[model samples]
Target: MDYQLIWVLLIAFAVFAYVTLDGFDLGIGILFPFEKKQENRGKMMNAIAPIWDGNETWLVLGGGGLYATFPEAYSLLMTAFYIPVIVMLLALVFRGVAFEFRFKSRDHTNHWDFAFAAGSIIAAAMQGAMLGAFIEGINIKDGHFIGGAFDWISPFSIFCASAVVVGYALLGAGWLIMKVDGPLQGKLRAIAKPAVIWMAANLAVVSLMTTYLNPAYGDRWFSTPNIYYLAPIPIVTVGLMFWLWHAVKRREKTVFGITLSVFFLSYLGFGITLFPHIVPPVISFRDAASPDNSLSFMLVGAVIFLPVILGYTAYAYYVFRGKIDDAGYH
Candidate 1:
């Protein structure tokens, strides 16, 4: 197998894992304000406390993999995305502080809660903005970033950010439904149903914009042989949207699985939509890849370490599995 392709796919897989895992916690934070009862809010926090940090390890892995295996792509991408990425990190700092402080300072709990929610929003928005900007295409001059600092700021990016907020909310709702019971769960279902609708709408808008505003993605996604092969992606995605709504309305415990499936399918579709390109139209993976020896060295270490990370992640989730009755550290 081509070590380059292997590393590329592994990095992609790592990113998908990060989005799906951290996505729920971010969703929970976004949905924090909706659950008014203090006890219920605490329970929401507790449900994610044990494994939230572990969930973020995938981001580090993905970033480290990219920088190690594809330094050129990493350099160019960071050059284009440095500002939002920095802001996103700062937001995560606030989130981490709030996560620890909210438990210690009873009188200022609300303030910490606000910080956590705000941080989640900022991080999610920055991520979505980056995604939108990447999709739209980052400016490059002779293989270097030439885009202005504000290149990532746009109406479409804002819409993508909002969509991610709702999508994460739905994931949070599904998690709450599984891990909590009673009126809180029911209220979560109420929030989730609409979240699914809004998320679906926003996803449609992003898809259309990607297909129309950017002809390269459009050509790849809607072109002849490619269209035939990829048609099931959207068809299943549409079906899963309805499935998620119905499952949420019924308060199914397994809605989390369905919710994750939706994201997995979407991730797969996005990969297909942008196949061969690591950055976009101009920068194919081969173009952006590091030298063969660099890739080969990383591939060996990655092979040994990837499974260890997955095993650890699975173990953490297993240990933390169950209902959340009260808010507190697990």
Candidate 2:
């Protein structure tokens, strides 16, 4: 296999990891204000506190991998998405500070909680907007961005921004259901139903819009060979959605596992459909990839470092396993 193809797969995996892991924490933050009681909000925060920071490692790896193996795509994307990137960074900083400070300052608890929620919303929105803009393709002429900085704030981008918030909420709810018990778990179970419904609706809308905006996607989906193989992905996705709904309603312990499966399957569908095209019609994997030497060097480092990261992440989660108690941070 080609080194470029290998690097593409690695970067894709990294992106998926980032989205699946850190995504729920952002969702939890967004949902924090919706909880009726202070105790409920604290439960939500405690559920994610142990592993949230570790989850962000995948984002760093994804960005670094892109820079190392596909310098051109990194340069173009960074240039086109400068403003959103900055906003995301600021949001991250605010959220991180708020996460720590909220527990320390009893008097300022409300202030920090608000900051955390606001930061989470902004960060998730900016990420979704950037993704939508990338799918729409950057306006590049002579290898330079020709579009305005606000090019990412269009209708489609806004829809994606809102959709991602709901998506993350669903994930967060699932996580709470798994890690918490008693009243908080019951409340999360109730929340999961609506969150899942919203996510399904948003996914349907995004799919329809994508097909409408790019006839190629419709054609590809309706085509023979691809359709036969790809049909199971959506079919299974809908089935899992229904399964998740039923599990949430029944207050099943496996709801979170099912929810994670749903996300994984959906991501797999996306990866299959979007492979070999990083920025769609305008840019392809081969065109966007760095030189073979660069890819090889990155691959070597990734082989050594990836497992260490995964190992430590697994160990941390294992060590922190079990329900969060009122004993607080240790």
Candidate 3:
């Protein structure tokens, strides 16, 4: 149980890292429709061009870690979310292709831009849907997935998809607030105002939906003793949202930090809401986790290489600091 808990925590941390790091880049792509100028678009791409590839490492880490540590959980999740997962991978491929092709063609730049932005939207939406479906729970029988193909498709998942899109947009807007300035930055600040508002609204809706739609989660949250541990999450989230609103309005550089804080807080709330059980309710992570020897072996490689990954990510960002104004590569 101890090792299982550790492995799950490791995988969860990887997930948060991927969502926080790659999320903004995807958000930048989501912002494509608003910008008409080619140069501005170029700069947008340039801003993320250096570390974009590295940002994807966290996805691999998270997915790979889950598969390694909790094979059963990973297997059931994959079987249930087969289509959405495949679609997300395809969209990510398009985003990568657009990154290269958009730079190569002058006449077809807008065409590639559309592809890039659309890919971001598709990837982000699918991820959100997957998350919502995960929270809603998968159909399990005899410790295996018994649900049909469309089980993940639902209205709640659709709303979650929208929430994820808005969330990524807010993250991207906040990121831009740090990296660029002038008219473009001003516009981002303005855009961020509504993005913040919508994000808060989405958070509210999703929180309500979780408690209403999933009685297990609702009972877990609303019941006594548990609420004492859980109350701080919502309280802190409200405070951060208010602070984020103030930062955006004041045109403070702290928007980026606050945005990251919001993401962290949201992730924290999610973890607290669903813990001990990787699949929720009946199936504990301990039941799904791999044997101790296998987990230990996997954890060894994970711990050894994590620092290297973080170091590389940090160095890449450091080398590419400052506002991007051109299409030049680092």
TM agreement with the true structure for every prediction: 0.97, 0.95, 0.96
RMSD of each: 1.4, 1.7, 1.6
Worst 10 residues of 3 by lDDT: 321-330
Ranking by TM-score: 1, 3, 2
> Per-model C-alpha lDDT, please?
0.86, 0.82, 0.87
| TM-score (C-alpha) between model 3 and the true structure | 0.96
Candidate 2: deviation at residue 280, Å? 2.7
Please tell me which model should have the higher TM-score, number 2 or number 3. Answer: 3
Task: Compute the lDDT for candidate 3.
Answer: 0.87
What order do candidates take by lDDT, descending?
A: 3, 1, 2
Off by over 4 Å in 3: 327-330
* lDDT score of residue 85 within candidate 3: 95
Between candidates 1 and 3, the one scoring higher on lDDT is: 3
Q: For candidate 3, what is the total of clashing residue pairs?
A: 0
